[model samples]
Target: MDILVTGILLGGTYALIAMGLNLQYGVARIMNLANGEILVAGGYFAFIAYTATQLSPILTIFLVAPLAFALNSLIYRVMLQPLVNRAKSRGQLESDSILATFGLSFIGVGLMLSFFGGDYFSYSFMAVPVEVLGNTYGANRVLSFVMAVLICGALYLWLNRSRAGLSIRAIGTTPASARLVGIDVKALSAFTFALGGAVTAVGGALISTYLTLDASTGVVFTLKALIIVIMGGVGDVRGTIVAALLLGILETLVATLLDPGLTLAAAYVMFLGILLFRPQGLFGKKPT
Candidate 1:
């Protein structure tokens, strides 16, 4: 029971982390390697706000989200749009984006290192213990989980119920067809990319309340988000949520029953199994 509750809380946050990447890669068709950096940046914003202003990290989302969105939009316009225009094929664009964002990741790391130095940062917020199902857990973790649930739920509704969301889904499903139907694929892709960055930043703000993070820690999150996105299938929101929960449970079980150090290895093993057997993801339909 303890493991289940803990893992669910952890997976809820992971869902937020991966959802942003899914939006970027699934709809914008840009494989952003710097995604984790954006998340880390969001954490930094929360850390700064909490330390300087004594503001709650949860409330920092309003400030972080828009800032991330603007910066990400600028990055897309200045750095990625040219590649999108010049690429000869989807494969080429993806390859170019990988290289471009890989460089961007390094730049982000360097900037963070220069400003913040290489030290771990954490803050206490709602740090009291909360009992659930005969197990005690940190209140911050529970709060973060609740916030994640609300944000994800709202996002799901927007995607499924709104006209703009339908267009975004159409673009993700078939960009060419969406274009044929008069959707401005380029403009919408840029919006999706920026929105993805904002969502990822919000995830970071929530996570900073519970996790120790440093300038270089972003890469770890980047890889984790990548794994979750792939395992869930690109653009599949439901799959991402389910896969994140499964991963959380698996990691919790492994850490509790085996060695804590083996949790990451366990994740890799699962990822490998998914790639080998269900390359299209657990919920994703096989490509025709």
Candidate 2:
């Protein structure tokens, strides 16, 4: 029963981690390999805020999310956009984005290391936990999970039910047409990447409080998110969330049943197995 609750909460956190990747790769189609770094940065940033201000992490996100978005925008503008704009090589656009994001990812991680040094820092705030059907635990973790769900739902509604969302979707499906119709793809791309970054920041703050973090700590998060993103289907927001939950629960179950060492390998094998049967993902549309 405890494992079940743990897995559910952890899965929601995983979904939070995946939201940024989904926005970047799934909706905007940017292969942002470095995005996981944003998670690291945001976590550290929240730690700093917590250490200094000693405020609740929920409040810390308000202080951090905007910074994350701004940093993400800067990263896209300075490091990534140029590659997309200047590349004349034979490689596809997505390939170039991946390479560029990889380069930037390394640079960002290195810069972070240079500045902060490698150290594990954690933050926590006990605002009191509400009993749910008799189970009692930290309210902060549960609050973080609920906030993650609400955030994802908000993002989904914005994409599916809002005008800006429609425009963004139109741009992704047919950029040339979108441009012909006067949609600013460049601006939209920046917005999309920033959106991803902002969400990652929230994820980072939540996860950092729940666990420990180092400068280069987001690698596992990145890998898990990437797997779930691919297995969920690129550009499918809903699919990403659903896949994250499924994978999170399954990973938890596997870790319990087998050795902890096999958890990653198991998830990898699961990804491969799913791909073999449904190459597009659980919610991805079949390619034409």
TM-score of each: 0.98, 0.92
Please list the Cα RMSD from the true structure of every candidate, rounded to 1 decimal place: 0.9, 2.1
Top candidate, metric TM-score: 1
Clashes of each: 0, 1
Q: Per-residue alpha-carbon lDDT of model 2 for 206-278, expressed as tens digits?
A: 8777777888876777888888888877777787888887777777788888876676786788789877988
List runs of model 2 lying over 4 Å from the truth.
88-91, 127-134
